[model samples]
Structure formats: structure tokens, C-alpha cells
Target chain A: MENMHLDQHISKQFNTDLEKLRTAVLEMGGLVEGQLADAVKAIETGSMRLAEKVQETEDEVNQYEVNIDAQCTEVLARRQPAASDLRLVLIVSKAIRDLERVGDESSKIARMAIELSDEETDPDGFVELRHMSSNVQKMLNAALDAFARFDVPAALKVMREDKHVDREYKSAIREMVTMMMEDPRSISRVLNVIWSLRALERIGDHARNIAEHVIYLVRGTDVRHISIKEIEKQLDQDQ
Target chain B: MENMHLDQHISKQFNTDLEKLRTAVLEMGGLVEGQLADAVKAIETGSMRLAEKVQETEDEVNQYEVNIDAQCTEVLARRQPAASDLRLVLIVSKAIRDLERVGDESSKIARMAIELSDEETDPDGFVELRHMSSNVQKMLNAALDAFARFDVPAALKVMREDKHVDREYKSAIREMVTMMMEDPRSISRVLNVIWSLRALERIGDHARNIAEHVIYLVRGTDVRHISIKEIEKQLDQDQ
Candidate 1:
């Protein structure tokens, strides 16, 4: 009976540690999502102040990445967790990396926002920027929510939504090209918008990465280097 | 006496496993570097067949990433390696991800090579592209060499070289913008070249990432999210 009690105590401690790691990862995800949203808003409003805020928030996101990585390392070393527990730690570590990259891309967008705000371009260009931003932000939010709930279907939905952002981005790029061709003087400003659109498209790619991580975690399979159709078929079998 | 013999055998097994993992990582690095060089050559020669070769090479690179990840996962779970061994696995896994990204960017450049072959742009632009490609490929080669030999100074050199690529990229972007402004009819072709330059810049970033991983692995430090001056200072202290 005493041995059983000790086993329970040890298992409970591990559970606590695992929960802490999960919570830290989710918190970092939330912080990245916030930075991304503010970056989009900064671009739309041409607010240097909001862009600065996004940059400041990135330092915190970086801290979370370091902290979570340390925690995962410690757990892996101490617990020697196997099977599902091992998988969880590995996935969390990998996901933390994806989150950190998302934060990096958000900072890139924020920097572009600051530069774009300094110059004036067609306000019509921003309508496309706004559209792409919202779609990507929604995809990122869904990815995070799916991560939180371990929802594979929601993650798959995010993957599908990334295509829409890609199409929007291509159109935005073509539009910018046409605008520059029409008005040569607008070259620099249009280039800034083009770079920002590129950043947004990359943000969509990062969200797709997070969704892939969620799928990897829940399904015990790696969906990377595979096509969307193959991923979908795999998901169907998993279900 | 038997226990001592058994201890030696277990240690030998671990050493073998660790060596295998390192060999795999180095092999992957070599393939990525080859693909990067081939991609640059494809652009310089404007050979569709060479560009297609780079694309096919990416499949092998992707398999390396998946295989290396599995080996790391298995080692972490089964060996439960501590301290330096654990760090080795972690760093190797992270570095493999960076290398895979480099391969992806190379594939992107190769695709651009195929597209740009059909269009004529300023011959001057090719000069800049060639300069950026050679510099980045050199950086990547140095990074992989450093990883193979665990050479921190070589890694530092690669990190410094990344800045040169960035400057070249910025200048290239300016050149492309000027070309677009001077001849609007060249807009589409210049845009393709611009996108290809962006990919080269990202390839530099990935090389920087690999360098940072080497620094981390050799020195037990996290040089990421920090300035180059700080990294230099830290290296001085470590030396």
C-alpha cells in the first residue's frame, strides 16, 4: 500500500510537469498570435506605435521559447519518458521552434509595417493586405485553438485555409507589379507593400507548420514533405 | 569483472549509435550543400534540366530530415542520454531542420531559374545574382564543414558572411527596383529575379541558423536572439 502511494506521487509529479510544459507552449502561441494581429493592425493604420509594441512583444515571445526549451530538455533528461510521454515532449520541443519562427516572421512584418507607414502608396493596395492578413490571422488562431484542444480536424481546416492566403498573396503581388509598372515613381513604396505581403504569406506558412505539428502530435505521424492530398487521406484513415 | 566488461559494451553501443547519428547529419548537410550549388549553377547557366535536378534532389533531402528525426527520437527514448550526448541529439535535430529549409529555398531558386530562363533581363542583374549566390553557397559550405568538425571559429565566420549576403541582397533588390522603374515592360521578369534574390537571402539566414547551432553545440550556449557582438564576446570568454 505504501509503495502504491509512492507510485501515485511520482506519477502526479510527472503530470504536473507535463501540464506546465503544455501551458508554457500555449502561452507562447498566444503571444505570437497577438504580435501577428498587432502587426497587421499596424500596417492597416500606419501606426508606428503599434509596430513598436509588436517588436516589444517579440522579446517576451523569445523568452518563452528559451524557457520552454529548457523545460523540455530537463524533462527528457530526468524523466526518460517513453512512448506517448516521449512523443509529447518531442512534439512540444518541435512546436516551440515553430512558434519561435512564427514570432520571428511577425517581427519581420512589424518592421515592414513601420517602413510602409513612412511612405504613402495606393490605399487600395491595403484592401488586399487587409484581406490577406485577416485570412492568415484566422488560420493562425484556428491552429492555436486546435493545438489547445488537440483537434485534428481543426488543424486540417487551417491547412486548407492556407491555400486561400497563398492565392490572395499571388494576386496581391501581381497587383503591386501592375501598380509599379503604371507609376514608376511608386516603385519603392510598392516594394514595401510587396515585402509585407511576402511576410504575411510566410506567416500563413508558419501557421501551416503549427497545424502540421498538431497533427503529428495527435496522430503519431509526420505529415511533412507530403502533399495536402496525402495528408488528407492520412487524416481520413486516422479518423 | 563481468560487470565492468558489460559497462564497456554498453558504452560502445552508445558511441556507435551517436556516431551513426552524426554521420547521417553530415551526409544530409553534404546533400543540401550540393543542391544549393547546383541551384546556383542552374541559375547561372539557365538550364531547365539542371533546375529539374535540384528539384529531384529535394526529395532525397526530405527523406534525410525524416530519417534523422526518427533516429534522434529513438535515441532520446531508448538511450536516455544525458548532458553532452543529449545536447548532441537536440542540436543535430535542430540543425537538420535548418538544413532542410535550406534545401527548400534552393528548390525555390531552381524553380525561379526555370522561369527566368525564358525571359531576358538586364545582364547587370545577373552579375548581382551571381555574387549573392556564390557568397551564400560559400557560407553554407563553411557552416556544414564546421558542423562536421565541430569548429566554432569556422561557424563564426559563416555567421559573419551572412551579413555580406544580406547587403548584397539589399543591393540586388535596389537594382531590381530600378530596372522595373526604368522599363515597366521588364516588370514581370524583374519580379521573378527579385523573388529569387529573396530566396538566396533566406538561404543565408538558414546558414546563419546552422552556424548558431554549431556554436550552441560546441560551447553549450544559445547564441540566437542575441547580437553578433554579444556572440563574439561570449566566444572570447569561452576561448
Candidate 2:
């Protein structure tokens, strides 16, 4: 009976630990997603206030990262999880890194927004750059959803979306350079827009990283820099 | 007798493992340093050949990074080191990350050099930026020396040198912007220089990261983003 009671206590503790870890990661994901949204909105609407808010929220995101790191260390020390649990811990560890990079991209966009305050006019800045932001925002939202649901298909969709962001980013850079060539006065403002778009593209990559981690967590394989068809084939072969 | 034999085996294995890690790191360091120097020369002398060499060298650096990562894992699994050893292993992991980032910066500079061929300006075009690159190269060299000697003072000296890089980086941005404004047609060529300097600033930062890891590994304390005086006080207090 004593042994049975002790086993019950340990099992309960392990479940609680798992739950805590899951909640922590989700909370971090939610905060980072919110920051990404704010960053997009800041650049989309040219809202310096929104940019300031995103900058402020970075502190909270950093704090969450620190807390999650502490929690991972504590859980590893206390429970000594094996196999699946160990894999979960490692996935979370790697996910935190991706999430932190996302936070960096957000702050970088906010910085561009702040720099945008001195801007005047680029002919099609909004139509071109904000369009790219929308695509990147979609990728981020999908990545976060896949992370929440552990949906491999949704994760794959996000990975596919990154190309659109990258395409738009390069196009935007070329367009901005031409604009600066045509009018030197537009240099700073156009550069600011180009920088924000680049940041958005980087944020899209970070989202893809999260999706890749989600795929790895569910499938025990990495899908980085690989096509979805290749990943699916590998998954099928694994079975 | 068994315990003594075990100790002898452990010591022998530790020596071999440390040697492998050190050599890999030194090799990566040397390769990245050469890449950066070649990248700057390519930019200065308009040598696509030099740029191509830097690109080819980056592959070797990437391979070194992969090998170091596996070695770190194998070492960790074989010898569950404690305290100082643990610190050393973690610091090496972080240093590897820094080296990889430096490789990335070198590649970026090389790419800029490749792009420069299409828009070659007067040879006087990159004087300021070339000086910035030289400063970055010097810092990187000193940082590697600091790592080799485990000299905290030398590492601190490298940290203090980041200010000069930053100062040059900021002034170069201003000068580049002015040049673009003065001649709108020059925007494309000047943007490449701006990007190259930005890459150099980032490479210097990676060197700083390596220096900080060195300080942490030897002292068991994180000195990142903190002042040299604080690091000195910590070391003094420790002794």
C-alpha cells in the first residue's frame, strides 16, 4: 500500500510537470505571436505607439524565455524523464530558441517603425511592403496554430508560405533601391521600409522553424530546408 | 587498483576529447578569419576570385561546426562532467554558435563582393568601409588569441574594442546615406557597401560573443553585456 501510494504521488507529479511545461510553451508562443502581430500592425498602419508597445512587450517575452529555461532545468533535475519525455523537453528547448528569434524579428520591425517616423514618401511602399507583411503574418499565425494542435499538415502549409515572404522581400528590396536611385530624398524612408520587410521575412523563417520543430516533435524527424513531399515520404517510410 | 585504472582511463580520454574540441575550434577560427580577410580584400581589390574562395571556405567552416557539435555530444555522453567541466562544455557549445555566426557574416560580406562586380565604382569607393573591415579583422584575431591563452584581460580588451567598430559603423551609414543623397545613381553601389559594413559590425559582435564565452568558461560566471570593470571585480573577488 505504501509503495502504491508513492507511485501514485510520482505519477501525479509527472503529469503536473508535463502540464506545466506545455502551458509555459503555449504562453510563450501566444506572447510571441502577439508581438509579431503588433509589429506588423505598427508597420502596416505606421503607428509609432504600436511600435512602442511592441518594444515594451519584448521585455515580457524575454522574461518568459528566462522562466521557461529555468523550468526546463528544474524539470530535468527533478523528474529525470526518459524517451518521449526527454524528446519533449528537447523540442521545447529548441522551440524556445526559435521563439526568441521571432521576438528579435518583432523588435527589429518595431525599430524600423520608430525609424519610419522621419519618413516622407515612397511611391508604393504600403501596397508592396504591407502586402509582404500580411503574407508573413499569415505564416506566423499558421505556425502558431500548428504548434498548438501538433498538426503536421498545418505546419507544412506554413513552410510552403515562407517562399512567398522571401520573394516579396527581394522584390521589395529591388524596388526600394530603384526608388532611392530615382529620388535621393526617399533614401531614409525607403531604407526603413526595406528593413521592416526584411525583418518580416526573417520572422516568417522563424515561424517556419517553429513549424519544423512541431513536425520533428510529432514525427521524430527534422524537416528543415527540405520540401514537404520529401518530409511526407520520409514519414511514410518511417511507418 | 580498479579505481586507479579507471582514473587513468578517464584522464586519458579527457585529454583526447579536449584536444579534438580545441583543434576543431582553432580550425574554425582560422578559417573564418581568413574568410573575413579575403572578403574585405575582394571588396577592396574587386576580386571575384577572392569572393569565390570565401564561399568555398564557408563550406569547410560549416563542416567543422557539424563535427564540433557531434564531438560535443559524444563527449557529454561519454563523460558526465561536473561543475567546471560542465561549464567548459556549455561554453564550447556557445562558442561554436558564435563561430557559425561569424561564418555567416563572412559569407554575407563575400556575397556583397559578388554583387559589387556588376556595379564597380571608382577604386576610392570603399575606403572607409575597408578600414572598418580591418578593425573587425583585428578584433577577431585578438579574440582568438584571447581564447587560445584563456587570458581574461585580453578578452576584456577585445570587448572594449567593440565601441570603435560601432562608431565606425554608425558614421559609415551616415556617409553612405549622404553619398546616395548626393548622387541618386550611386544608391545601388553604396547600399552594397552599407550591407558589407553591417556584416562586419555583426562579425565583431560574434567575436565579442566568443570572448564572453571564454570569460564564462574560465570564471564560471556570465560576463555578457556587462562592463569590463564588473568582470575584473568578479575575478578579483573570486581570487
Name the regions of candidate 2 deviating beyond 4 angstroms. Answer: A1-22, A70-91, A120-124, A145-156, A212-236, B1-11, B123-125, B223-239
Supply the global lDDT for candidate 2. Answer: 0.75
Model 2, residue B14: distance off in Å is 4.0
lDDT of 2 at A190: 81
True contacts kept of each: 0.74, 0.38
| lDDT of each residue in B54-121, candidate 2, tens digit only | 98887687777667765765565566555456455555655776787787788888899888877745
Distance (Å) between predicted and true CA of B182, model 2? 0.6
Q: Model 2, residue B207: what's the lDDT?
A: 87
Q: Identify the leading candidate in terms of DockQ.
A: 1
lDDT of 1 by residue, B1-239 (tens): 00001123357888888888888988998998888888888888988888999999988999999999989989998899987678788988888999999899999989988988887654447788888888888888888888877788888889888888898898889888888888878877877778778988998999898888878777778888888889989878766
| Candidate 2, position A36, lDDT | 81
i-RMS for every candidate (Å) is: 1.3, 3.5
Q: What TM-score number comes out for model 1?
A: 0.93
- Reference-based lDDT, each prediction: 0.83, 0.75
> Which pairs clash in the backbone of model 1?
none
